[model samples]
Target: MTTATTTAPPVLHLAGISHTYSGQRRRTTVLRDVEYTFERGTFYTILGPSGSGKTTLLSLASGLDTPTRGSIAFNGQDLSHLGLGRYRNKHAATIFQQYNLLTYMTALQNVTTAMEITGAKPATGSRKARALQLLGDIGLDKAMATRNVMQLSGGQQQRVAIARALACDVDILFADEPTGNLDEGTAQGIIDTFSDLAHQQDKCVVVVTHSQRLAAQSDRVLNLRKGKLTEQANTP
Candidate 1:
């Protein structure tokens, strides 16, 4: 007698999804018939040129917006059925290229506020401690963490945004040009954190960037061009 085996569904799946933006006299289709599956414990990087709809793809997949055609599913349940807001609140976190930090709040406050809003609990210690540790891990010292974001440099604010997202404890982490504002060494550290989040913590990480160095570090590299996306060979 032989036992049967079962396979788990993808953490996120996009099936024949297409998105179009309407203008005054025309419509622009950014993605066409895009089908892909994102699994947990994997790091993915998306590379694309300007006007190629990389951000749009990220928005759709991250539940910021729905596709004009087709469906997106999280763990086999359609996003439309699951409710996009609910999905975002419970399962996904995004680090935007603009480093959308609360300018009036200190770095530590921004991270802790996000944790509170997301109801993310630390494995140990209080949320403030966890936020401070995450901030420090990304090169922000205690003094820097206590300073208002407006006083921090662009790169420092970027680190705070990353820390805020990381503290959320979401299943999938999405980033757009995550390291564009950082120095080489700091950027590399962020890349290492992304890898660790996927491999060690069993989370899915997706980043949209134009940097080949960042792309080279991911498990899968996908290129989006002319409204289409294709995966390159595995990075080994």
Candidate 2:
């Protein structure tokens, strides 16, 4: 007897997504008829020139904003039906270049704050402990996690943000210019963390980066031009 085979559904899928902004004088189209599928266990890099809508695509994919047309599906469910807030809370996380953490909160506090919104109650330990462990996983020890985010270096703060994103316990991570402020070595370290998150932890990581080093490390490279997406051969 032959056993039946099953394929896992994509963690995220975008079909014919387009977005346009309207002004009194003119209507501007940022994205047009873009189609893509993202699955777990892989990292994707989006490359595009400035004003090419790379950020716009990331925002839409992470449920920060909805598209003007078309659909985004999360875990096989239509995103529109999932509700944007629910989609972000349960299925996705975004890490911005600005490190949009609560400025006055400690690293740990920022992480736990995200948990509060997601309504997560860790089964193992207190929420704070879970936050510390997550920071530790990203190489931030207790002392670092307890420090105010303002005191941390660029790279350290980025890791703390990554920890916060992980604390959300979602399946997809969206990062925009994540390493823009770091030095070469620190930037590489950040990229390495993203790699491990996708390949080892089975998260679907989508990063918008201008760094070739970053693109080279990703499992797939997508080029955005005039609001369209085309796959590029992965560079060794």
Candidate 3:
């Protein structure tokens, strides 16, 4: 008799993903045959120079775009086979360097909007409360939660973006240059928040960053060069 061996499904998987864009004059390949896996409760940082397809890779992993020649799977389900919008809403959330919050909206409003968009089952007030709670968790206070995003500093705005991402309660968080605009101390604080999210909250956190400090804080570091991926050795 032969015993069957089962392999665990990755929380997120990318297999041979490739992407290209065609313009009138030339075609440019952004990602090339990339493959990686992210498990729950782990923080991964993808590091590379500018124009290295880091953001493109994050978009594809988050189901924002379809791969040209490969597959992305979430818990054994193919991303292409699922409803991409619903998949993104339920399984992943993205934070960008720009914060992407409405300038006129309060921090709580920004987070609640994400929760509403994701179809989370909570009353508006409850959602706001949860949003505020998340903001507090990320080191923001209630006063900041009620203030307009434009009134906040850059680091504060980025913290709000992180709170908004967490509001959706998705299994995976995709962040693109989340600390690009902050100072060293503030950036370190943000990295600590991400670490807590992955270790304490059991979330899979993937960040595309160029900062060595941020890479050092992650559970694993993936280096992307000209769209290819390799694991870095010095990750914590």
Candidate 4:
């Protein structure tokens, strides 16, 4: 006789999440009682039309902003109680379309700086070796890593950004329009990198994008409309 063990809870749980803006004339609601759970080892895509509050959801999820109602928890701990700063520093990392790399620093330095800010524990491994290894993992050669971010191609810069995020060694990765500015080939490469990170590295990957191609490649496609999330069936 054998007993079955229960799996751990989701990495991220959104409970009745809602947000709104109050103006002198009136109030506008952006999100309406949204519920979602994002688990590890999966890549999920959130798609929506313009002004549909996609960025707002990402902001709240990343702790860049708070919801007007409801709560979000990571690893069964409320984000509010865990503290947004600590959560951002120690629990998750985001990759943005703009790359957002420090213009003054080389690619390696950019990653090194991010790890330093997060104060990544030594338990995760050595900062220098880890940064170099991460950059290599994402297809950036040592020569590219040594160049200033401004000197690298868009695709190269994005890879450095991804490396920086991974250097944090967080369980969850959030991306916003990551391939928006890249060419078709470059975009596909970036998408592939994300997929590898989710499937092989076991990082919970969530991307907010308008690209249907991206959604198609994801393990799950979620449509966000007027503040609600609906799972989309795979098109035949």
Candidate 5:
């Protein structure tokens, strides 16, 4: 008789992670024993007030910063053991609040640059096609794709940023205040797009937001206060 073995799903895990900033005479702890597990197909939001270490948590989760203590693992592999730059390029993507696109590059060029950063070797025609497709997926049109980022509005620039983040086919996406600059309606649209990406595409979406609306839309809402996390009940 032949038997089949079942494999566990890949997850992002944080175990007793802690971070401290050392000053000349004192040390400030930014995170304390943070233990959380993030799985695919879920929109997870970390909600916290300013200086509550939410962004720091994102940095650690994305392998942009190392913990002062404990470990962060992705798919059972320790992130500390991996080269962070490569880890970010291959497995994780980030969208910032300011929409960090190259001012000189067109929307398509920005997305194509992201694909190139991931070492994707698509042909020139294919790369442009993929970039345009990504833009469309994020609700931008071909004309918008060809426009320089500087010529776009805030919301439009943010859409291009989202497309760039999606260009590399990353398993995990980290968004920091993704809708901080948008009006309510625009913010709702962006949140909806993130929701679809998480639920439909089966990607792990971690967002750091102070917006209750965004947090409510997530599958799980985690509250970070004074360097600790607690799940919020009654989240939408």
Candidate 6:
């Protein structure tokens, strides 16, 4: 008897995707024919200048927005057919640069609420247990976790955002300038967490950052320039 082996499709794919912002008098195009394939168990960092549209690309890939032209797919299925809201809730999690936490909730509440909304359940414990653990892992202790997010500092709130995303237990993780508000040590720890998510957990981790130190640790380095996305050779 002979057995057949099947390979899984890429976690996320962008095919000739372009995006533009239309205004009252004129339209501005940010991306042009951007094609990329992101696979599981890999960490990717996108480098670009302030106006290079890295956020737009991340937004499209994370299902927060659709491209102006072309298409995006997850696991070989087009996002259009997959339903953007469903994709975002069930498959992808994003850590916005602004740390979009629920203002009325505590740090722990923020994480647990995300897990609840995403329908993520822990294998061995209650959702509260998992949320607390994830928050602690990101350096927020029980005291900080119990406090409202507004009471926390910017770096602390950023950690809460990261914990919320981690608790979602999604397939793809997207982060934008995640370390911008952190100190050096904390920033490095977050980078390590991202690396572990990709290599250890087999998740597709994509981060948009201007930090070369963070980019150097990623498995792949992508650069967005002049409305084009290109990969740079890995450097030591």
Writing each residue's lDDT as its tens digit, candidate 2 over 67-125 gives 99999999889999999999999889999878888999999999999999987778899
> Each prediction's TM-score against the native?
0.97, 0.90, 0.91, 0.87, 0.89, 0.97
The deviation in Å at residue 162 for candidate 4 is 1.7
Off by over 4 Å in 2: 1-5, 121-124, 137-141
- What candidate 6 gets wrong by more than 4 Å, as runs, is 1-5
lDDT agreement of model 4 with the native: 0.87
What lDDT is obtained when candidate 1 is compared to the true structure?
0.96
Could you give candidate 4's per-residue lDDT for residues 110-205 as a string of tens digits? 999999999874455678778888888767888888899999988788888878887887888898888876678767877897888799988899
Selected candidate, larger TM-score, 1 vs 4 = 1
Candidate 3 vs candidate 5: the lDDT winner is 3
Candidate 3, residues 61-156: lDDT per residue as tens digits?
999889888999999889877778878989999998778898889998999899889977454568878888889876789998999999999888
Global lDDT scores for all candidate models: 0.96, 0.90, 0.89, 0.87, 0.88, 0.96
Q: Counting only residues 3 or more apart in sequence or on different chains, how many pairs clash (N, Cα, C under 3 Å) in candidate 6?
A: 0
* lDDT accuracy of residue 141 in candidate 2: 91
Candidate 3 residue runs with Cα over 4 Å from true position: 121-125
Query: Number of clashing residue pairs in every model?
Result: 0, 0, 0, 0, 0, 0
Return the lDDT, model 6, position 182: 96
- What residue pairs are clashing in model 2? none
Question: What is candidate 6's lDDT per residue for 41-147, written digit by digit as tens?
Answer: 99999999999999999999999999999999999999999999999999999999999999999999999999999999999899999999999888999999999
Cα shift from native, residue 99, model 3 (Å): 1.5
